[model samples]
Target: MEVDTLRLGFIGFGEAASRFAQDLSQAGLRHIVAYSPSAAKAVLDDAIRKKADDAGVELLKTPKAVCERAQLIVALPPGSKALAVLRRVRPHLRPHHVYIDASTSSVKDMEQAAHMLDGVAPFVDAAVMDPVPINGIKVLTVASGSHAEQFRAALEPYGMNIQVVGEKPGAASAMKLLRSVCMKGLAALLFESLEAAQRYGIADVLAADMARFINGRPFEQIMKRFVCGTAIHSERRIHEVSESLALLKSLGASTRMTRAIRETLQQITDMGLREHFGAREPETIAPVLDAIIDAKRAQRT
Candidate 1:
C-alpha cells in the first residue's frame, strides 16, 4: 500500500498524536485528520485549520468523524480513557478499516478491544517502542495482531522501525508490559536508593558511584530508552506494568518490586511528571531525582 495515498485518522490529538501527524505530513502523506477531546471545538478547530492550511490536511470534529474519513485509525488516547474512546468509535468502524491501538492498555483491555471489533474491523495492538519526541522519524513500533501484517504494510510509507511481534491481539502490549517491569522498576529503585543515600548524607558520593555503576550502561541511558522509547510511542505504560505484575504472579514470583515500581510511577504520574517527562530523554529525569534527594535531606535535617 502506498502511504502517500493512505488516509489516516488520529484520535487524541495530544503531543504524540500531533507529532505523528506532523511527521507524516512532513513525509508528504497529507491525507490525515485528528480530533482531541481536551481541545475545545474553537481551539481544536483553529489548530486543525492552521495545520490544514499549512499541510493540506483535514481536522475532523468528532472521533467518529475522523474514523469515517480514514482507512487507518490510530488511537493515542490516555490509557485510562482509551477503552471509552474505542467503545465510542467501534460502531463506526468498517470492514476495510484497520484500527491500531497505540495506547498503553492492559492485555485484557487489548483482548477485549479485539473481541469487540472482531469481524468488523481488523484490530492491531501496536506499542510505540520509543518516545516520538526524541526518536522523531526513527520511532520504533512493536505491533501484533491478526492484522499486523496489513497494518505494517500500510505504515511503511511513513518511515518507521516497526516490528511485527505475532498474530495475537495483545502480544505487542505484553512485550511492552514485560519490559516496563524492568525499566520502570529500575527508575523507582534508583529514586529510592538515591534518596536513602541523601538521608545518610552521602548523596554526592553515591551519585558519583551510581554514575560509575551505570557508566556505559547508566540508569539515565536505560531510562532514555524507556521514556524516549516507549512512553511517547504507547500511552499505556502504567497498565503494562500491571500486566507485568500479573506475569510475575503467574510465575509464583514475588511482586514486591513490581508493586513498588507501580507506586513510584503513580507518584510520577500524580506529580504530573508524565506531561513533563513523557517525551523527555533520560537525562531530563536527573534533576527530578536530585530534587527528590534534596527534599528527603531537608526532611531529615
Candidate 2:
C-alpha cells in the first residue's frame, strides 16, 4: 500500500493515537481521520480536537463515519472501552477494511474483539510494547491474529515498529501480560525496599549497591542463581525477610510487598525445599520451580 494513498482512521484520539497520527502524517500518509466521543463538543479547548488538529487528523462525529472513510482503522480507546467502541463500529466494517485493536486489554477481550470482526474485516490484536510518549508512532509493538502480518506490512512503511508474534488473537496480549508480571512485580519490590531504605537515609547507597549487583553479570545467569539459591536457602531467606519486614514496619514504610515475600519464602521452606536439595544447591531454576508446582498440585488434589 502506498503511504500517501492510505486513509487511516482512529476510533479514539488519545495520546497514543495523536502521536501515531502525527508521525504517520509526517511520514507522508496525509489522510488521517478520527472519532472520539469525548471530543465531539468541537470546542477550541477540547484536548482531543487539539491533538487531532496538531496531527492533521480530520475529526469525524461518529465511529461509523470513520469506518466509512478509511480502509485501515485503529482502535485506540482505553481497554475497558475497547469492546464498546468496536461493537459500535463493527456493523459498519467492510470486508476490505483492516481493523487494528491496539489497546492494553485482557486476552479474552482481544479474542472477543477479533471474533466481532470474524467475517467483516481483518482484525489485528496489537500490543504496544513500549512507552508511546517516548517512542511515538515507532513504539515497539507486538501484533497477533491471522491478519497481523497484513497490518504490519501496511504500516511498516510509516515507521511503525510492529512484530507479528503469532496467528492467535490473544498471543500479543498474553505476551504483554507475561511481561507485566515480571516488570510490575520488580517495580513493586523496588518501591517497597526504597521506601524503607529512605527512612534510614540509605536509599541512594542501597540503590547504588543494587545496581552494581544487578549489573555484575548477565541477567539470565543471575536469574538462575537467585531462583536456585532461593530454593536451597529458603529457611535462611525467610529469617532475613522477617527481620527486614519488622524494620520496615518500624520505619513506617509500606510492608505489603515485603510481607508477601516473607510468606512466599515461608511457603518454599515449608515445602521441604532444603530437604529436597539435601544441602546441595540446584544447578538450574527449573528444579526449584517444578518443586513448587508439584507442591501446589498436591495441595489441590
Candidate 3:
C-alpha cells in the first residue's frame, strides 16, 4: 500500500499524538484520525477541540471508531495506561492491522503489552528518544518487534527516524531507559552540584569547573545553560519542582528522585538566594551566592 493512501490514527490525541499527526500531514499523509479515552474533553476544552480540528485530525469518540478507520494505530497513552488502552482497542483489532506503542513503558511492561496482543495484531515497541516539541516527528526513535521492519517501512517515509534495535520485543525500550538514566542523572547532578557551589559562595568558580563536565553529556548545550541559570530563578524552580512532586504524588507514580531534587532546590530557595540576581542574570554565580551568604549571616545575628 502507498504511504499516501495509508490512514494514520492515534489512540491518544494528547500532545505527542497531535504533533505526530501534524508531522505526518506535512509528509503528505492526508488522512489522520484521532481518538481520546476522554473524548468528552472536546466539549469541556475548547483548546483541545480546536487543536484536533487544526491538525486536520478527525477526532472520534470510541476506540472502535479509531480502529475501524485506520489500519495502523499508534497507542500514545501514558505508560501506566498502555494495557488499558490496548484492551479498549483489542476487540476491534484485526490481524491485518499494526499497533505501535509509543508510550513510556518499562522493558518488562512493554513485553507484557506485546504478549497481550499475541495473535491479535502485530505490536511494535517504540522508544521515543528526544523531546517531541523540539525534534518534531523526526525525533529519534528505536522500534523493536517481529514487525519492526514493516513499521519502519511505513513510517520512515513520513520523516520518522525509526531504527530497529532488535526483534526481542522490549530491546528498544531498554535502550531508551538506559539513555534516560544518563540524561536525567546529569540533570540531577547539575542541580545538586550547583547548590553545593552556591553554599560555599563559590558558584562562579564552579561554573567554570563544570564547563569541562557539561561538554560530555548528551544534551550538553541545553543542560549547561540550565545548570548555570537555575540559581538565578531558584524560587521559581523550587515552586515548579514542588508542584511536579505534588503531581506525581497525585498520579501515584514513583517520585523518589523527584522528591530528592525538589528538596534540594527547596534548600537553596529557603537560604534566601531566590531571585538574588534580581531582573538580570549575573555573569558570575558569585554575586547571587554572596547575597545568600550575607542573608544567612544576618539571620544568624
Candidate 4:
C-alpha cells in the first residue's frame, strides 16, 4: 500500500508514536488515525492532545475504530499495558491488517503478543532502538518475525531505519533487552556516582575521572583492570566505597547505591577472589565471574 494515501493508525499515541505521526504529517502523508485508549486518556496531558489535533490526525474513540479502519497499525502502548491493548484490538484485526508493536517490552511478552495474533493478522516485533525525537521519527528500529521485511518496507520510505534481525518474533525484543541491561545499568551507576559526588563537593573530580576513564584509556583496558584487578583491589575498593558512603551519609545524601557497591566488593573479598585468580592479571572475566558462581553453588549445596 502507498504510504501517502494509507490510513495509518496508532494504538497508543504516546511521545514516540506522536513524533512518528508528526513526522508523517511533515512528510505529506495525510491519512492518519489514532486511538488514545480511554484507559490511557486520563494520563495524557493537554499538550499531547493539542499536538494530535494540530497534526490533523483523526483521534478515534475506541481501539476497534483504529483496528477496523487502518490497513497498517503501529502499537505503542506502555510496556506493561501492551498485552491488554493487543487483546482489546484482537477481535477487530483482519488478515489484511499489519500490526507492528513498538512498545518497550520483554521477549516473552512480544512472543506471546505474536501468538495472540498468530493466524489473524501479520505481527512484527519492532524494537525502537533510540529515544524518539532526539533521533527524530527516523530512529533506528530492529524488527523480527515473519512480517518483518514487509514492516521494514512499509515504514522505510517515511525516514525510519528498520533493520530486520530475524524471522522469529522474539529476536528484536531480545536484542533490545540485551542492550537495555548494559546501557541502563551504566546510566544508573553514573547517576549514583554523580549524586554522591555532588553531595560531597567532588562532582568535578568524578566527572573528570569519568572522562579520563572513557576517553584516555580504552574501554577494554578499563574492563580488564576492573574485572581482573578485582582480585587484588576488591578490599581496597570496598574500603573506598565505604569511605565514599560515609561521606555521602554526612552530606545527607542517599547511601543505598554506595552501600550496594561496597557490598559487591565485600562479596568478592569474602569469596577469596584473590586466591581464585592468583597473581597474574587475567584478560577475561569468565573465570572471575565463574568463581563467584561456583561459590554460590557450593553455598546452595
Candidate 5:
C-alpha cells in the first residue's frame, strides 16, 4: 500500500504511540486511528485525547473499532498488558491484517502473542530500541517473526526504521532484554557513582574521567581489559569495592550498586578465578567467561 493510502491503528496512545501517530500522519498516512482506554474519560482535558487530536488521530472507543478501521494495527501498551490487549483484539483480527506488538514485553510473552495470532494475522514482534519521544517514527525498531520483513516493508516506506533481525517470534524481544542487562546495569552503576561524586564535590572531575576512559579506546579493547583484569584481580577488587561502599555510606549516598560490585567480585573470587588465571590476566575474555560458566555449572550439579 502507498504511504498516503495506508491506514494505521494504535492500541494505545501513550508517548510512544502519540509520537508515532503524529509522525506517520505527517508522513502522508491519512487514516490513523487509535483506541486508548484513557482517551474516553473526560475528553476535554484528557491528555490522551489531546495527543490524539494533535496527531490528527481518530480516537476509537474500542480495540475492535481500531482493528475494524485499519489493517495495520500497532500495539503500544505496557509490557504486562500486551497479552490482554492481544486477547481483546484477537476477535477483530483478519488474515490480511498486520499486527505489530511493540511493547517491551518478554520473549515468552511475544512468543505467546504470536501463538495467539497464529493463522489469524501476521504477527510482528517489534522492539523499539530508542526513546520514541526523541525520535518519533524514526526510532530504531528491531522486528522479528515470520512476518517481520513484511511489517518492515509496509512501514519503511513511511519513514519507520524497522529492521528485521530474525524469522522466529520473540527474537527481537530477546535481544532487547539481553541489551537491557548491560544498559540498565550501567545506568545504575553510573547513578550510584555520580551520586557519591556529587556529595564529594568531584562530580565534574569523575564525569570527565569516565568520558575520557570510555571514549579513549575502542569499546572491545576496553571490555577485554576489564573482563580479563576482573578475572585476575577480583580478590583485590572486592576490597576496593568495600572501601568505596564505606565512602559512599559516609557521604550519605546510596551503596546498592557498590554492594553489588563487591558481592559480584566476591563471588568471582570464590569461584577460583584468581587461581585459574594464576596471577596473569587472561589474553581474552572468552576463557574468563568459560571458566565462570564451568564453575557455575559445577555448582549447579
Candidate 6:
C-alpha cells in the first residue's frame, strides 16, 4: 500500500483535521486537501495553511474539491454535521474511493452514511480511541465496514494504529460509543464525588483512598484531574456524557450511569462553573476548587 501516490482529503479542517494533516505531512505522506464550512472555511484555511506550509500539504476550498482530489477521504467534521457533509460530498464521490468517518456520530448515522455511499464508494466507520492532542498522528483507531482493509491500508501510511473491528458499517462506532460510556462515566463520577468531598473537607482523604483503590493507575490520576477540571468545563463534559448515553441506548444497554452523569454535569452548569473550568488546565483546577469550597463552607458556618 503505497500511500505517497494516493491523495488524501479532509472534510472539516478543524482541530482534529489540522492535527491529522500536520502529522501526515511530517510523516512524508503528501497530497492532502481540506475543506470547512463557508463561514469557518477561511479561518480554518489560514490555520491549516500554516500547518500545511510547515508540513508542505495542500488545502482545498470545497468539500467537493476535496473528494475530487483524494481517493481516501477522512471526514473529521463534528458529529452533528457529519451527515450534512456526506450529503454534500456524495455527488462527487467516485467508485473505488474510500470514505473514513472518524467523527463521534451515532451508529444509525454511520449506517445511514454507509448506505448513502454504497456503490459510489466504500464507507468505513472509524472510531478514534484517544485524544488527538496527546496521541498525535499515531492515534489508535478501530474501523468496521466492508472496506475496512482498504481504509486501514490508506491510513497506515499516516502512522495510524488501526484495527478492523468487523465488517458491519456501525460496529466500530458501537465499540467507541460503549467505551465512551465507561471512560466519560468514570470522569463524571469522579467530578461529583470530589466536588461533594471538597465541600465536606474530605477531598484529600478521598483522593488518597482513590489512589490506593486504583493502585495509583495513571488513568485514575488523569480522571482525578478530569474531575476537578470538569468543575469548570461541565458543558463539554456534559456533551460527551450525553453522547455516551446515546451510545448506550444504541447498544441496547441501560443508561443508568450516563443518566446520573448528566445530572451531575447539570449541577455544575447551574453553578455557572463552565466558563471558569472550560479553559483551565487540569493541574490548576484543584486549588481553585479548594478555594471555592472553603468559601462556601465559611458562609454556611
Best by TM-score: 2
lDDT string for model 1 (1-301, tens) is: 4566688888887767777777777877777887776442746446645655464556677877887788889999987777898999998999989999989888899999999999899999988877889876568888999889888888776776678999998999899899998879767766655555565577799889878767768676767665544433334567988886776566555567678668766655554443545555445555666544655566579
Name the candidate that leads on lDDT: 5
Error of 5 at 90 (Å): 0.4
lDDT of 2 by residue, 94-152 (tens): 99899998989999999998888888899999899888999897788899998899888
| TM-score for candidate 2 | 0.84
Ranking by lDDT: 5, 2, 4, 3, 6, 1
lDDT of each model, Cα atoms only? Answer: 0.75, 0.89, 0.80, 0.84, 0.90, 0.78
Runs in model 4 deviating more than 4 A are 1-7, 28-30, 37-61, 106-108, 163-192, 195-199, 217-236, 242-253, 266-301
Candidate 3: tens digits of C-alpha lDDT, residues 1-301: 4676787789998878888888888777777898986654468457877887778888888889988899888888888998888888999999988999999888998899899889999999998888788877889889999988888888899888999999888998899998888778977766655554565577788888778665666665555456446665666787788776676566555567777777767766676554555646656655656776787788799
| TM of each candidate vs. truth | 0.67, 0.84, 0.69, 0.71, 0.82, 0.68
Per-residue lDDT for 1-301 in model 4, tens only? 6666577899998788888898878877777889885533634566766788777687788989887779889999898998998999999999999888889889999999999999999998989999997976778889999989987877778777899999999899899999887788788878877887887788999899889868987887877788889866788788777788878787787777677778889988888877766756667877877888998888789
Give the TM-score comparing model 3 with the true structure, all chains together: 0.69
TM-score of 5: 0.82
What's the candidate order when arranged by decreasing TM-score? 2, 5, 4, 3, 6, 1
lDDT at 299, model 1: 58
Superposed by TM-score, candidate 3 places the C-alpha of residue 184 at a distance from the truth, in angstroms, of 1.7
Per residue, candidate 5 scores C-alpha lDDT tens digits across 120-229 of: 99999999998998888999999999889888887888899998999998999998999999999999999999999999999999999999999999999998998999
* Backbone clashes under 3 angstroms, per model: 7, 0, 0, 0, 0, 1
Which sections of candidate 5 miss by over 4 Å? 1-6, 38-56, 218-220, 249-253, 272-291
Cα-based lDDT at residue 121, candidate 3: 92
| Reference-based lDDT, residue 128, model 1 | 86
